[model samples]
Target: MTDKVSEAEFLQGLIPQLRSEGYEVYLHPTAPVVPPFLADLRPDAIAIGKGKKLVIELVTSESTQQKKTRALANLIKEHPDWELRVLVVTSASRGNELQVQSREQIQNFLDEIKLLQDSNHVSAAFILGWATFEAIARRLMTATFEKPQTPGRIVQQLAQEGYVTPSEGDFLRILAAKRNALIHGNLHDLPQKGEVEFFREISERLAAESAAA
Candidate 1:
């Protein structure tokens, strides 16, 4: 791994190896993104697990404080949500890398949500479906925001950051409220089946668009 090809070779060798361990890893994501608080700096890749996010950095040398190496440490320190893991791979023969633990439950829950969406079970579908989607939103918010926020505030932050439109944010706020009420057994305030589906549709669209953007 020498020349300009080293970085690409490193990332290519590492990606599937990481995925094989069951991480929801993203590589230099182009959309559905909020950069780290540090300007002009982004992790080489990110991996999300149960309650932890990993920011991966490839450093050539640690003997000196290169701009990127210093910035990477600062960004990790600033974002309490993420754990920083740096691989010092300067030498061409270096093969060291972090073996991140898996978060299979999250993937399982997402699969369950898809199944619920197609099932005839009404209340189970609505309640679990919304909760699952909310879990996703919460994960994104935790990754983006500096501090914890309420559900509505999460949507607000997304909108303020230009990730979501104001109209979409309004819709999500109402949806989140209904999801919360459902979780708390406020059945009377629960959205109707159609309403629930509508919210899910909109949420799915937003997720898909952002992923594809």
Candidate 2:
């Protein structure tokens, strides 16, 4: 029986894949620096591959130490390795600080919408698409600008900064209204197809700008 059997089990399951990729895997290699977690719960293991050192943390579904996990990840990135990486394996929701949806994620969502649209689920797709777009917008605003308490305020602030065209800004305001209505149990106020498309276009632009920054 190992001291941390679950973590060992996780490494056992994953190491074969790392070896398949030609990495020299190690179990619990000692580090020059340790992340500040609870004194007892440090990194579970380490993997060296492709000229980088990966600090591995095996977390369960009930784990709640996300801020520390991220802090440790950032700390790992700041150090020297062939290159540095942190592998956090978990099956639970992390904090909002770690929830920036990537461009590929958004593209996958759009693809799903296309599939749903073909199945005559247009309204459902549109609603979900707007929610996703708004989430991106809110994340962008909070990261690059002041965080607003509400979606409408975030859109308005973006417009005020000349980040959005007047037409796009107006459309976003409409979507915010629709979101409010939807939350209040009114489906009739959902955005139209063209409006949702405009949100998509604006969201894509914002995402590109964020990446460039």
Candidate 3:
């Protein structure tokens, strides 16, 4: 309802809500991301469903000219399967220099994740584990980058900034998708307990060091 958030944050928030409605979201799709029908065009984000595809465009004050925007809008209007949703953003994120959680608070959440895991609520544990990752990763990301990023981007940025290794980043990216499914109740099987523990450990360490920095 608020356009005060940056386009990145706005897009990030839509992803989960869209997934909950059975949509498959693709961010900044390129040739390989979309089928040949949309190969020549790029949307800020794409949400595909059984018989429809939503083409999302974020318009800032200094965004692409109105002519281009109109063209894209008109092009989509001709297609029955596509619909355009434009987001008019008033401002962009400039990043933050602060962490979102206290060390004690993060530790408490970590413990809760573990408790759920040990109690055979592994699905809940894994879901909570990723939420923990987001809290810490957001802190690191706001401090390091100029814009707010999604969980997928946060993991990549953490690796790029040397906060986590390349392998850790790769694994986290895969988990991020599963996390989406878990959050939306589409996941059938819980991830391995060891995998959840690894994610928890990484987040725990990141929160400590990020706060220290």
- Alpha carbon lDDT of each predicted model: 0.55, 0.55, 0.66
1-213 per-residue lDDT for model 2 (tens digits): 332565567678777876776777766655443333323345656666676665565433233444444445445434556222223233223323335556566555555444434433445445555645654665566565322236677777778878788888887777788867764457576566666566666776776775565
Q: Give per-residue CA lDDT, model 3, range 17-111, as digits (tens).
A: 88987899988887665555554667778899888777776654334334444555556545767766555444444333233655566666676
Q: If the candidates were sorted by their TM-score against the true structure, best first, what order would they fall in?
A: 3, 2, 1
Compute the lDDT for candidate 1. Answer: 0.55
Candidate 2 lDDT (Cα, 0 to 1): 0.55
lDDT of candidate 1 over 1-213, digit per residue (tens): 552367667777777766765667877754455354656677777777677676676544222323464455555556667655544343354344312112233344334434434433334445544444444454444455333335777677778877677787787788778767755546577556676566566556545544443
Best by TM-score: 3
Winner by TM-score between candidate 3 and candidate 2:
3
Candidate 3 global lDDT? 0.66
- Residue 83: error of model 3 in Å? 40
Better of 1 and 3 by TM-score: 3
Q: Model 3 reaches what TM-score against the true structure?
A: 0.50
Give the Cα error of residue 140 in candidate 3, in Å.
2.5
TM-score of each: 0.40, 0.47, 0.50
